[model samples]
Target: MTKLSPETILQHACIGVMGLDNNGIIQYINPRAQELLVCDTHNGISLDTIAPQIWKQVKTLIQQGMNEQAIHIQGPRGGIEMVVSPVDKKAKTSSDNFNGVVCFLRSHEKFESSAWQYPTIKEMHLQFQSLLDHSYYGIYIIDGNGIVLRVNDVAAGLIGMTKEEMVGMPIGELAEKGIVDQALSPAILKSKKPLTRPLYVVKSNKYIMASGMPIFDKKGDIRFVVVIEHDMTIVKELRDQLKHARQVADTIKNELSDRNLLELKSHEVIADSPAMNQLLTVLLKLAKMDASNILITGESGTGKGFLSKFVHQNGSRKDKPFISINCAALPDMLLEAELFGYEKGAFTGASNTGKAGLFELANNGTIFLDEIGDMPFPIQAKLLKCLDDGEIRRLGGTKSIKVDCIVIAATNHNLEKQVQQKKFRQDLYFRLNIFPVHIPPLRERREDILKICDFYLKRYNKAYNQKKRFSEKCIEQLQGYHFPGNVRELKNIIKNAVVIKENNVLDTVLPPGKNKAVPISPPCEETAAPPASKGLNEEILAFEREKLTQALNHCTSTRILADYLGVSQSTVVRKLKRHGLSVE
Candidate 1:
């Protein structure tokens, strides 16, 4: 006999051979298999992509760790036959040790002529014994006669019976005996197709999401039905919790409606622009009737914290405490302890007496979580639990304390992007984002600039006992500059202009990093004639550097400065480099 390599033997083999990993992803397909499958290149592709109909049955068999069985099918090319067998890695033939599968493919004509031996009764029983290894989902295999051929431990327990008791019993008997609320096998056999429904077992008092798939014989008659069930106990609990939360919200809204609400001042919400006016209208309604959680997002200094308090002070919790905490201010341990409270001996240097957390103190009120995007990952889970269960447990505490408070979280960071990057939890984001409010940056609403300036200017003048006012040039400069710090920065500019300068008509404010004030013309201001000594290009370059330098004061990064300058980040970088300037 001549020495034959495995590759050479595979190439010369009469039947097709294909290998698939546990996930049903094609690991390798011999040339013969590719020819039969009508695919020249089939490696590294999913088995489902090649043969969706056959893939489902093959998957079920792999999950069941059944014996090799020939599956006849009709493909696009012609009649085909596939025999799937699970490959066990360990010496013990069990599903837990099965890592992959080896498939044998052939034409239906050849398969019918061949005398392939079927698995014996002992071999079938040994293969069925591996069903107990699957712990995640309940699995059941009922034959065409509706008699249970195999039952995993999980499925047996779900029906309040032993595996041996469940095996050989007709599925219809389980329903008649009141072992299960209903059986999926009966419907699957009738439909001869896959179906999923919630199965309620009266014996265990558990709800299971049952999905049954039927396997058909060559004659198109149903051969077996595989039922896979997932436990829905947690889902049911979550739904109940959500219902309770809604009820609590309704109670709070009713309470607020019954009481007299305070009239809000116009200056408190500054909405001269249509965008602000629209946002304020929504906020007012949310504060009055809706008790849902709120999420306020904006750049830093855009008054997210102020809006959060505005909602609290104007809502049903107006008479109650309004506690606020910066999530990013404290270390991880301290933040958790502060938010959820801690036992006296929870950690080293602990308080002699156990402390009440912000959540406990803010009961029946609102707790504002600022910079929520910066919250630690481990703490996010606890926060989610509190929002869901309406309770919180102190560190090192045995019992969970009841705390009911509307959580309003604020973040300047792009939470969606952070979620994609796995830095923020998607569930927590969705929970706090029940009622979203975004405060547009001040530069976006230029009309509001003068209104805000007039309001703050008069207030600052009264506070300082001065009647100073902004000159025409000063007003123009304020409107033209990009307010990177939003309303907060604009207010400070007006205040500084009123209090610091001796001139009654302030023409210029002191620029950042300069002791002396610098005159800043608005973008719309007519260009001043350049000195005769300077060329046009030189003058334009100089003007660009000056604007870039001033914008850099309010911005910490090139990305922000680019947005303010209305230019691409690359353009900003190139300009900065040309002018010998950087963000720092």
Candidate 2:
């Protein structure tokens, strides 16, 4: 049998083949090997001469006789696995006797067994190319030197470039265009793990989310990086819509809270008489004075506080805040802190950001101090200083802040009498008394009762959507009675009558009894003076005490007792206390 030559055997092989010595010198190469390497088939065409760098590394492994196994090499066309194995022992011995160490080379891209399906070298190459070209996601394979080894169609289209142009380019070029640098590169390199981040694609000027992972070989060495990009424009738009919705909701919430606060602070006051009109006029005038400190005096129910709001709104500072503080509402320490702000951490439970006091919030506005006579004596001096200097220092802060505001003080007590009795500071009263407006009791304004009652009736009728009116008889009865609780009592009476009187006319009478005409004593007796055995003063006093007892028994409240007796509530209280009776 004739033996074929090495050159003839290699030329007939179906895959690329080459023969190498133990030192990795290319002893022989076949036609297929030359075609795959893109090199010429010339004499002395050694592996080192064709691929100098890879040959040097393979030489060291070959010397150990371990048969450097199948290794994948990425090339321009596709990937190829090169398997190096020792020749048959007899062949190796014979070859050593003739030439040098011998090795048989086989291309791992092809195999015949079912276990190795997709066996043909051509089939494997086509399969890998199909995956790269048809993938849905953008895929990029970058080497350790930061040069792109291969980019799929998806990745090439992402940067508006062809696959051939993208290959061999530095990854930094994409970064320079502000495409995926800041978050992508550092995360993959530093953490050496998979990472996802938002990125802008320069070619399309679109937003995308990029995820990258480091690829490791069997030896755990980082070989390449694989990056995938997904577009994110729709997601960003949805987020913006959600943020706008939240802002609109917050604005509505704030508006509703402000309206509720306004309603809670407002109070109703009844007025009709000329005396009350005169007082209101004076208050309006005082409110116009930008620098005046007005004082209001009246009984508890005579609407002193309601007039204060009138003063604030009619003033030049109407557009600014109108802050009110009830002097009797809080304890001394709290009142101080509420009127004068405190520094952060000044006291336990204080806000971390510090709070603005009412006075600070009321700058360029008005501050209504209701029940001013009840303010503590110790704080009066500080208040007086604030009025005099037009400045206030916070409870814990060192700096003094100047303020421009109007101060309106209202109380039922006679401040002059309180000053003389040492219950109020004389200097503070003088400072606050730039203008004094005194409102009269409701009884003194008898003509205005029916008018005020009709006003309330109409208001309630409109509110309830009912058409109700007051009867002449009921109006007469109300006018005839003396209201000791003043206008406040009159409003309450009308409100109660309108609520119970569902019909067109309100004819409900007073609680004591229906109105009845008193019979005049038979024309004064000229002879009656003759029967005055007992003193007239004693008889009159006895008759007053008897009436008081009867009225108290018939009334449910001191206010009602005063109404029945045709006297003031204070007058009833004084008489009850004088008679050793507990009004409560």
Candidate 3:
């Protein structure tokens, strides 16, 4: 039998085959190789014309007599793996010492065997290096010690570092310097599984999404970690932009809704008592007129804020802003500045571009002045003027800005008593008294207790992740009890009960039986007796004044006062005149 030539042997090989020269030009390509590579060029084609990536790495390999285990080159139809081996031209012919390399190409997708054949170590290394260098993702190969062995161009560019600088660098050192956090790589090695984390590349000021997988050795121990990274900076920026856009849209929606019209509404207040239901009907009727100023009288934390919101939300100007401020919270000066915005530099540290006051912010809307009794005496006069004239001047500006805001003031104080004592202006008191809404205390509406209890119990159960039930005994006990804090107190009791009780019945968090509410305000001096003076006449007068004031509270009539004090009617009238008490 005639011995087969090298070309004949290669052409007959089962896998694809290619041979190149020292100048990186393709010398020979078998039918299998052409079919796998799908190259358009024939005999005279350079390796670069067929596959640029393979040419780039394979040329260096041939020059150094380096070989690769396997490499995957892509084409339109399929992917081919190339295993390279050095070709000895000197042994074949003396004319050339280095002919090039013979690459054995195999299609991964067209494998006939169930098990894959491992390529030689040299071929494997070249294949891996080629794939890693040209990948779009940033790739890092790390050893068990967390030292980077190799990196791709994409990875280096993300950190603003060259591959030369990163290779052999410890991942811990990179993290310490804020280049990219490789903490997940360590976890992958520990768990022998893949891990992913979002990282901020401080050096490049960009966000990266990184995933890492552990590569195990023969002993099933993690030998190295391969981390792949993708840029997420644009996605994060878009998310923030979306959040801000939603906020702006919500503001515009609120601004444009229900403008300048406060539609009449009934039963906005949550109430079951006859008094409350009747009061709500009247309140809605007055709100429909939209001409009268309103004064809401109720204890602190008695759903006053909720009622204020209801008034604004259900009224003609319901679509407009309902601005509320606590009159007692700030000092006189700060309250003035907040109520009426100052001109630029009106006071030390004032805003350079004068601010708009709550009243201004509430223009064409409703401004609820809370704790109105606590407002300073001077502000009260200015407030009265503003209410009467429909205009207000800033703290320092001479110009009075015309405003059409509806004023709704609320207080627990007895403004009628304040007016009689001269602490509150009489005219302002009368102006606010129009369409008065006097919310009854909880003790007067015992029927609402169970309804209010169920409402708050359901609310707090959802909040605290509880399903506590109120026993019949518990319900009766709560209903019988006087809630001085009213709706606010009931809400707190239920809230605490939900947290404390583990069983179906909430009996642990019930409040003490004492019904008196804690006083929200200090006693006005008008009710206090005159203090004793140094003189005998002053001491006698103080005693008389104390007796008269005490009597005045219960018995306003001189005839009744005389009967209660065991004194004559003329004597009672004489004492009333002397002490400046009314004797109607």
Model 2 Cα lDDT, one tens digit per residue, 372-432:
8878898888889989998888877889989878888888777898899999999999999
The residue-level lDDT of candidate 3 at 83 comes to 81
Write candidate 1's Cα lDDT for 98-182 as tens digits.
7788999888777655533445645665666665555588998999989999888888887789989988989988778887787
TM-score winner: 1
Which sequence of candidate numbers ranks them by TM-score, best first? 1, 3, 2
TM-score of each: 0.44, 0.42, 0.43
lDDT of 3 at 563: 61
Whole-model lDDT per candidate: 0.80, 0.69, 0.75
**Model 2 Cα displacement at 346 (Å)?**
2.9
- Ten contiguous residues minimizing lDDT sum, candidate 1: 517-526
Candidate 2 error regions (>4 Å): 1-272, 509-584
Clashes of 2: 0
Candidate 1 Cα outliers beyond 4 Å, as residue runs: 1-263, 510-584
- What is the TM-score of candidate 3? 0.43
